[model samples]
Target chain A: MLTGAETEVVLLSFQVAGWSVLVSVVPGILLGWLFARWHNPARALLQGLVMLPLVLPPVVTGYVLLWLLGRSGPLGSAWHSVTGGHIAYTTAACVIAAAIVGFPLMVEGIRLSVLGVDRRLEDVSRSLGRGRGATFLRVTLPLSLPGVVAGAVLSFARALGEFGATIVIAGNIEGQTRTIPVAVYTLLNAPGGEPGVMRLAGVSVAIALVALLVAFWLGARQRRRVSA
Target chain B: MIEMRTRHSVRGFTLDVHFESAGPVLGIFGASGSGKTTLLHCVAGLLKPRDARISVNTRMVCNRPGGTWVPPERRKCALVTQEPLLFPHLSTRGNLAYASGAKDALESDSGWKIVDVLRLKPLLDRNTASLSGGEKQRVALGRALLSKPEMLLLDEPTSSLDAELARDVLSLLLQVKLELKVPMLFVTHKAGELMALADDCVVLESGKVISQGAPVNVLSKPRAIGVANLVGVDNLLRLEVLRHDEAGGVTLLAMGADVALAAPLCASAPGKTVSVGLYADEVMLCLENPAGISARNALACDVTRISEMGHEVLVELKIGLQSLRARLTPSAAHELGLAQGTHVVALIKTSAIHMLG
Candidate 1:
């Protein structure tokens, strides 16, 4: 039985995580393919840069995001100039922070699966009169689809748990950016908030467990497809 | 018709090949690692050679060094590799219709003809992963044919199969050649397949074209020692069918002037040339025409050449205008005191002479 405030926090968390996955899906697939297929000396460096958020301290990542979207920052100023609006401390900022924190997991999952595909199959497709793009869409993408879906689900789970980035950039604003992790954090410092924190923490654990199981199942399916 | 001149080097292996063939089915013959597949890849536009000029059916597909470079998809050359690289996610029907225009091709009368030829009608709904090796290859061939390629590129398409299955596939390929009449560039190391399918042949040894001609001519008189070794037969002769003894179940072939060799019954008409292979080890050398021998033929001949290979000796005997090679142990050669220009009788059995195509 979640209180009204708790329900709002849970709902907002879903909205933010959902948006984060939606915004990152295309770029994640593109970067994942590049990481898997590109044969250049600089590819490793670019991949490392994209994967930085996965290993870096979340608080530090949040601070960097804050600087980039802060009023004085170039991007922040440019946004203000283009739309006469601000991007900081908003729901959009919450989505951006969560998406950034979860991106590396998504990309790595897709990259490994794409790499697992047999390149000879693509050659056969080409020889059968399918162009590169058509072959990718028909052969490579379908073969690696399970992995791509797993990556998206994993990122969504990661976004739901994102606390440090959301707190720093979007702040713990109620009903707007006060996601489950932020709400739990907020409740921890206040008196008579242990019950609320317990419920949110349980929900978070359940969501994480389900996400991991789905990812593993999808990963197994991908291995079977490639091996077959 | 196809013409190719290309050179490519990878790691330590180099592929330098040049040949022109007017073929309904041209066979590229070579042993493993001899650049047969590499040459096929180059022609299929799957591999980019360092210096190359390739034309198929009078249209230039590739000309490197600031010339036209057509991609593989547009080359109209469909390749069926040794392994059936079917799309794993798709069913057999789906894989058969995967090419750009294959869906429409599947509905065409010609498409049904291909399906019938490959015997793929029953396996259409089965998952690709569930098909056996032979079934998979049949589907692969059908898929390639459905693409309506200008020329088919087959890279040892039957090598992975068992002997019986290989023969079945080979016959199917023959049917494809005769009934479908699609131009093809078939690659294989099997001399029999080359002889049976190719209108013209190119023999490759270590990345170079050693010989090019009709299959029977090139294979019968191998230009290089390497080709002779690859062909694995000491004697490959093209002889005229002299006559057939139906009751005796044998056909007589003219080997040379006034000399005839009896072989197993064949359908070749009299006066037509037929290629036959005989292993050197199967020929026996005798100093005199021995009596009461159960062997079929004992021909008196003069030893023209004697070459020692390892523990054995190869004795080349001249009978009329033809030469037949016989293998003997060092002890046997020494015991018989065999030498060049020595007169001896070469014994051969009818069963040992294998009719090659």
Candidate 2:
């Protein structure tokens, strides 16, 4: 029963969040593993740097991304020279902003899960004639599946509701970068935009409820398997 | 041959020892914090020692001078830790196949052989989390065997199991040795398991090799009395198998000129000397031989030494040329006037003597 504009906003929101999670999952899992397994003095520093976006304001993060990717910036000038296109104020910018804001949640979920895995399991695997790499793929990764799944779902939900950063970097272009949250913000500011706001807010709650249910189901299943 | 001479020190606990073994199974016997597990870890290449030279079958796995080191996977020494760490993500069959690198090949002949020997066919498809402690240990052993390891290093593998389950696992290990013919290093604090599984033994105490020799020699030697007392088997006598009376279901053995004992049927031939184990707690000391007693063997012995150990008093007796240890309560010792140079009768039940192999 969504209007044409509402339907466009919904589809754009999914597109932006889907791209954001898809691009960040691999790097997020890698950072989680590095934090879990690597032993070094700088490990705390690296973890703090990755978690900075979780505490910093979304608008500030967006400004930093815009400064780095704007046409006048070094990377933006180099890209413009090669391809003659701008990166800021685009759909790509919205994906980048959402991914940056959601990355900490993803990495944190996976890191805690990875840390929960027993290190003695890896030693047993190695004694079974498997190398370190093979053991990671066979034992470590499989045991940490619940965390990975939870991380992906959380990052996806965070990206779907992103607002301040998306508007600051990507702007509220209709049918292009106007994600559901950005559209809802724009609608509430205009005269008599209350009904549209109610619809979009309802959709947001539905998505978040589904994501949370999925995470709970996965975590419970993992615990049952462990204690079976 | 497995030979290791190493020194490792960390956090006030150090392991410094040297020994060589050419037997099928070597026993590393010690108390809980005696560095036995650390020595096994070094032999398995799980941990590198500070100064060391480790060779297995003439191939140097770790050498300080040559700067050669082999990782655990390359060392081909399968370590079975005290906790049976089966992969919880996989089923019992999957864990065995994981070791063989055959994704779904449990139907293979070698796989079935291991499954059959371990009596694990009924548990093949079950998830490891569903298996009991003893069942999980069987699966762990099966997994290690399937990997075709050059040697097996067991770190108190049966310590977590109850006495019955521990005996079951130890019997299975003996079967594995018979079938697989693989060199193994069994580390344990139990004297019974050490006697059952190992031919040559090394005793470690506080990160040093206190005794190294045949199991009987090391366990019964006067210098290793502390080790023997720690293991709870204080009296280890060398008795020759004199004859067998199959009708009585017993084998008669000679302790000396006048002292003889009957044991449960063993496979030794006549005149073959065998070491018989007796726990100090099992021996009953009486000032006068009691008629109508259930115990069959009563030998006259002269007490050589007496020592107080908490509530119990350990009395060493000289039976012919051999020594026997008997534990008595302090009150009983005082009432019986048990002291060195006293004459006493050492009565032992026929079933209490365990044949050490």
Candidate 3:
């Protein structure tokens, strides 16, 4: 029963959340594994830096992203020198904001699962002639897979709900950056947008409920694998 | 074959060991925290010792302090720990074929032979979590063997099992030693396993090697008191078989000058030497030799030494040039008026002496 404009907002939300998860999955797993297995003295410091987004206010995180990607910023100037393009107030900016905001949840999920894996199983793999990378791919990665799936779904749900970072970095442009949360915010201020807000809010609740259920199922599966 | 010299310290505990063994199976024997597993880890390249040099089958695997240090994958030493450690997500077949070249090896004749030996054919498709302890261990053994390793590093592989399962695993290991002919560095605290499996043995106390030799020699005449304590036997001796009275179902072994001890009948021929183990608590002392005693050996002896341990007194007896230790309560020693240089009779039953091959 969604209007064409409302449908566009829903589709944009999915696209942004999908891209965020796609770009973040590899780096999330890498950081998660490093946090779980690395023994260096500096590991704690690096982990704290990764976990900063989880504790920092979302509006502040958006401001930091804007500073890093603004026209005069170091990386923004570098991108201008390389490709003659700007990154702010675009769909790409929306994806970056959402991905950054949801990153800590993803990494924590992966880190705990990787930590639950038995190091002795990895030792046996190595002794059986598998190198470190091979052992990770065959043994550690497979055993911790449920965690990775759960992390991705949870972060996707988090990205769909991301509003403060998106509003600051990407602005409220329809069909490009006005995702479900942003559209719902915009409709709340309009005189005849009450019905539209109700519809989008219902969709958001349904999507979030499904994501949480899947995450819980995957988490229980991971626990069983570990205990087995 | 392996040669190692290592010194590793963790917190306050240190492991310092040096030995070379040409082994079909070399057993490392020690009590817990005595560094048996540490030595194995150093050789397996799982732990980098502070100062170390290790070689397996004449190939130098590790040499620390600016020398060559090969990683674990290339060391060709497959380690099987007390826990089966099967990959929980993989089925038995998948775990058996997980190594780099293991898929082909599993199809090879030799690999199938390992499966046959371990009786893993029936359990191939089963999930690893569904297998029993013994079955999991068998699959683990097959998985290690499929790697085609130069040597197997077994860290008390059967210590986690019940006695019956342990015996079954030990016999399977014996078959692997004889039929497969793979060299092994077997670590265990069990003396029976060492005698059953090791060609050469090293006994460790605290961190250093207390004794090293053939299993029988090192165990029977444990040079250090730590070994005797670990072996859990108060008396270990080598005696020559005097005669076997099959009719009475007993073998007479010479204790010393003009003294004979009767043990359960064995297949050892007359005049052959055999190692024997006896516990001090099995020996009973009497003020005088009584008549019509069913206990086989009641030899007259002089108490050479008396030492009091917690809750018990140890009496050292001199019987025809051989020394025997007997355990008694303080009250028994007092009632019998026993002291150093006192005359007494040491009563030993026919089954009290255990023959150690």
Displacement of the residue B77 alpha carbon in candidate 1, Å = 0.7
Better of 1 and 2 by lDDT: 1
DockQ of each: 0.71, 0.51, 0.77
Q: Residue A189 deviation, candidate 2, in Å?
A: 1.4
The runs of at least 3 residues in candidate 2 whose Cα sits more than 4 Å from the true structure, single-residue gaps closed, are: B64-66, B100-108, B222-225, B231-260, B263-275, B279-295, B298-352, B355-357
Off by over 4 Å in 1: B222-251, B254-260, B264-274, B278-357
Write model 1 residue lDDT over B1-357, tens digit each, in one string.
999999899889999988899998999988888999889999888899869999999899999978999999999999899999999988899999998889999999999999999999999989888899999999999999999999999999989998688888999999999999999999988776777789999988899998988887788664643565664445877889999999988899997878998899999999999988887888999999999987888988999999898887989999867888898999999999999999999999889888876
Q: Provide chain B TM-scores across all predictions.
A: 0.74, 0.76, 0.75
Highest-TM-score candidate: 3
| Residue pair clashes in candidate 3 | none
Determine which window of 10 residues in candidate 1 chain A has minimal summed lDDT.
A69-78
* Residue A181 in model 1: lDDT: 91
Shift of residue B100 alpha carbon in model 3, Å: 1.8
Residue pairs clashing in model 1 are none
Please give the distance, in angstroms, between residue A11's alpha carbon in candidate 3 and its true position after superposition.
1.3
Q: Give stretches of model 3 more than 4 Å off.
A: B222-236, B243-251, B255-273, B277-357
The fraction of correct interface contacts reproduced by each prediction comes to 0.90, 0.69, 0.88
Instruction: Decide which is better by lDDT, 2 or 3.
Output: 3
By DockQ thresholds, what CAPRI class is model 3? medium
